[model samples]
Target chain A: MENFTPGASFLGGVLIGLSASLLLLCNGKIAGISGILGGLLRPVRDDTLWRVFFIAGLLAGGAILRLVSPQVFDIALTRSGEVFLLAGLLVGFGARLGSGCTSGHGVCGISRLSPRSLLATLIFMTAGIVTVYIVNTFFGGAL
Target chain B: MSTLVTSFLAGMLFAVGLGLSGMTQPAKVVGFLDLTGRWDPSLACVMLGAIAVHAPAYRLIRRRSAPIFAAAFAIPTRRDFDLRLVGGAALFGIGWGLGGFCPGPAITSLPSGHTAVLLFVPAMVAGMYLHTLVEGLQVRRSGIVHPETVSRSPTLPPSPALQYRHDA
Candidate 1:
């Protein structure tokens, strides 16, 4: 409702799709953010540079956003630092263990009609929904 | 050089998309996920828009014999469903719900220099490194050399079985 932004969301999504398409067509790589970043943890010959540059670009892009549209960087969550730490660990470990995250499996994999990606997406989305519900109901809706 | 440049540009474009779509805002992401409590469907729109463009583009680009800048497409071809996939995704979901930040948005939000991003990113990296350590130990314990290491070592002839696994 009050915060809905279909137009901007759609346009942004198109740009994402375009970015993925560019990576795929040009580099013959899946534009999976987790995969790219994780690959850097243990470097591979020739593979290391692209991942680094891509990540650098992400950071630079973020800096640009901070300059152009600071509103996008707003933080509204009241979650504790401990919660963030836990969440980060789970996200990092889970994304690697599962072999993909939202971008890899959700956007790119699902678009390719991969059955595994489809199932993974469903599982994660369900898990997220359930987690949110539990936190909202049981944790006094602090998050 | 071209590949690196392309990657940098693509990453930038992807970040822009995430930002423009309101993905960088944890509140917006959480709002979308809050289905039972004042649901916001804008995130759904983002997905739809991304898929609508990428699906057809993927099919088209794949029709080419090889990519413009690379020898072959490095798409994942795994078909079998397994516990690791299910379990990992579930864990990731829980974290995502708790934090409202997935890998991409989290990285893109780094310039904000927020405590959440700073705390989250390093911990996430540690988690990733931990996975590497555990996997290495598992490989060691099982007495099976990691395929990457095996391939890298010129002395060891690449096992046909390992090659098949890589292709698949």
Candidate 2:
């Protein structure tokens, strides 16, 4: 496709894998973004610092990306504020309820061959695909 | 000190990967999900590359008695396939497709200071808080302490069993 960049995606994926590996090896953490963030909302003693640092690091990383490759942050599609709000609510609730998101279940869990993560990944991916189909078909492909 | 620093570095590396992989771009994510449309398989490649490195690396790392910085590996150990897991995932997928922003990318995109990310992240956090509230009520009514609540209290050390229940 016109937008596909397999090489960059692959290299990025390697970095993600390495990041997850490092976190697991050093901190014994799973690098699941939602889980990390959720833990912050209801923090425990001796557990809050790493999550804070990790999240801060994420924000810093974003800043670094902005400086290094401004083009990658480009927004192609514009959705209404209502759409974003609704989607955010759903994502937040569901990720916590489900206990993981893409990184935890899709990458780390699947890599560990965890059945729960595998199932969660499949369900979420399928749901996402179905949602896109519905939006394209009924909502005129724009939300 | 080392723990926080390492966590920050790992988070930075993860964000870089997310950006380099084009994950921060909602359109690209939507394209990957839009199989019927002119699809972009870049997301698939990202997953493949990530799994290729992490799977074996995970196996190797787990061989150690303990992680370098922590006393024990805090990995999820639950095996039951329940409705909460399935239903939550489905709801999350719907949100993901509608917005093209999952938790990671949404946070990573925050530094860009985009209006969309600003709107999305706060709402996501609110939703998470709502879940906590609802779960708290449920636990209260049931007269049972949720593992999540227990694990977060200072009175108890983080046991592998408790961590397993909520570590996802």
Q: What is the interface RMSD of each candidate, in Å?
A: 1.8, 1.0
Winning model by lDDT: 2
Q: Which CAPRI level is candidate 1?
A: medium
Report lDDT (CA) for all predictions.
0.86, 0.90
Clashes of each: 0, 0
- How many Å off is the CA of A112 in candidate 1? 0.8
Residues A30-51, model 2: lDDT tens digits = 9899999998887777888999
Relative to the unseen true structure, what is the C-alpha lDDT of residue B117 in candidate 1, on a scale of 0 to 100? 90
TM-score of 2: 0.95
Residue pairs in candidate 2 whose N, alpha carbon or C atoms collide under 3 angstroms:
none
Indicate which candidate wins on TM-score: 2
Off by over 4 Å in 2: B146-165
lDDT of 1 by residue, B80-131 (tens): 7888789989998999889989999999999999999999888898888887
Worst 10 residues of 1 chain B by lDDT: B159-168
Please compute DockQ, using alpha carbons, for every candidate against the native two-chain complex.
0.74, 0.85
Interface RMSD of 1: 1.8
